[model samples]
Target: MTSTVVEQLIVPIRRSVTRVFNYSRNVKGLKTHLEELSDAKTRVLHSVDEARNRSEDIEDDVGKWLASVNVITEEATRVFGDEDKANKRCFMGLFPNVTTRYKVSTKIESIAEEAVKISVRGKFDRVSYRPSRRGIEDRSHKHYEAFESRGPVLDEILEALKDDDVDLVGVYGMPGVGKTTLVKKVAGQVKAGKIFDVVVLAVVSQTPNLRKIQGEIADGPGLKLDAETDSGRADFLYERLKREPKVLVILDDIWERLELDDVGIPSGSDHRGCKILMTSRDRNVLSRGMVTKKVFWLQVLPENEAWNLFKKMAGDVVKYPDLQLVAVEVAKRCAGLPILIVTVARALKDGDLSEWKDALERLKRFDKDEMDSQVYSALELSYDSLKGEEIRSAFLLCQQYRVVER
Candidate 1:
């Protein structure tokens, strides 16, 4: 098993190492861009605009390019830094299927003030930016969407559990509407806070496999279940979970209603201190699985909120002065879908209007296809357009399951 883990990792690790090597030259280019931006004055005569354009080309392109690269590297590494199994599973397994959302704990004043510094807007109330807080700009605004975890959403969910009146809590939304993301966000904080004696987060795909799920639930409380039989595994799990004073189990992406007893995982209700949180696309599924608590429904992010979230991950790449109008039209087409926002934004990260227009056309024809592909496509150009294009192309084209990228 350990060897299998190493084998699984070699490919991505090698790919990462190769990326580091292949990008060394490009990294040097970043230094050159920095040198220019460092010296470029903010204010110039109107007549120098065209000449400035000619001179600032290196800095403009390199600044955005390196900034984008840093975005991916830093974001991917932090979210995906688990040492072994979690990292291995997380890179493709955990993160690809899910994006996280927590509450924004920052006050309105700070958010607005920070937006001014970044020169990005934080307000989404109007089609135009309010002039001096009382008027509007035809094409200016203070806010866009992001997939970042926030503090308020986190606190609300954690507190909801504390309310005894709430039972069989459910977070419902369409597939990839961040149902999984919400649960995972909560699970991380809850586990980190040591809020419970045991916390287990498991990905329950469409199959609803009891055997596999039993193994997963039992993974909590440090109990080793080398048991081969389903019943044996269940027995061990029940014993381990029975004594814990506080336990929280997150059953992620539950496709259908399942009897917890049959699966060998106990709902916290039995012990007065346990809680089971779930994510599902179907309300019926949540209702059926309402073992001990009520369900909470999550809607797709509102148009403004969704765009804000997507634009944040997308960073400066999507905010081109050149493609602003066309991109807004394209963003509208996403119909406030978080997955679509992410997928389309990622697909357009290269900042090519022509390519972006082509992708918009593609989305028109195949908008409802796998959200994963759309999201991955957003990063396709940047991650692919670099050198070693053939290697990148080959590795990406391979099937997701059991892919050995090395």
Candidate 2:
């Protein structure tokens, strides 16, 4: 009977010592486990495929799991660092150490169990996820000088942008007719209203540099392209743009139809919710080259609007009763062109009645081609406002140089 009692006591005591020894070794291995956990987390975060599937739930789960692992690893390191002391503390006078070792082993085992569970939960399948969008830079300041006549055109463009079927819209007009200004107003309104998830504006000058154009467009969304070749950059752009649910791309000063595919812009049936707004000097570029869904032709401002704009630029000069009549004639000479009107009006501003008369005479003297007369005559009026012969001669020399260079 005594032997049976001894055996029962001995078996439990032996098992307890073995558990303590095994747990001590496992605690040492916790550092390795922590390293693995950290590496796994970095892999998941940087993986484009994994990022696509990233969600709030997954982020929270990972965060909590990582925090818990760090805590356990730190505690285990401290405990295992003084293993000899822990072993000594386990013993009591004339009694085998069972309670302390048992407690330590259980705590370590509990942490290890949790670590396993987290590892399993952290494993995720790749899925589509939204790319981080760069904030749209506000351009409302440019719209301050927008012409009054552009109100109707701005409204029409805004309405067309809202239509589900119209993915591409074009604004075409003569140089300095406010094509850029009108589009800027539209872009500002769209941004303020949050009409699209992303809005990008790029200038495609007469000669389109594919890479430069791509860089500008990519800048809007904060996309960095590391591709060496033009086609590679386009490919990168295509992939990035594909992930955006709604985007508006504005191409200003386009001389010809840009190859949508070459630029990495999706158009036609594959456009998704993306919309393209462009401005060009030629209507043919919009209708034939770009094959835009709708084209809005921006005409020169009317006589009344031109006069109002001229007065606005001329300031207090137009308020003078005597100068008012001459100012009206100067504004009319601008021929309803905002650029010409603003230039000529500002030149004659604060000038005496005689200066205004001289400007009118110089404008009438220019009998060049119709377009040349319209543009250069107004410019010449501004040039004639110079105070002295030396200044005027220098100005004319510069003008001559400009013509030669052109």
- Which of the numbered candidates is closest to the native, going by highest lDDT? 2
- Candidate 2: the clashing residue pairs are none
Per-residue lDDT of candidate 2, residues 162-244 (tens digit): 89989889999866677877787787788779898778888898788899889999887778799999999999998898788
Question: Total backbone clashes of model 2?
Answer: 0
Candidate 2 global lDDT: 0.73
Compared with the true structure, what per-residue lDDT tens digits does model 1 show for residues 1-406?
9999998989876755444343324334434443343233222222235444433223243334335444434533442232132223345465521112111111212233332332222111222111221111111212322244334454667887767665356677655456665666666556556676667766687777777787667554435577788777777776677688777777877767777766666664565676777777667777765653566667656667766766765568666787776676567565555655665565556657786676555435434465544333332333344334442453254222112111
Number of colliding residue pairs in each model: 29, 0
RMSD in Å for candidate 2, one decimal? 7.9
Span of ten consecutive residues with least summed lDDT in model 2:
397-406
TM-score of each: 0.51, 0.61
Poorly placed runs, candidate 2 (over 4 Å): 1-137, 140-148, 366-373, 382-406
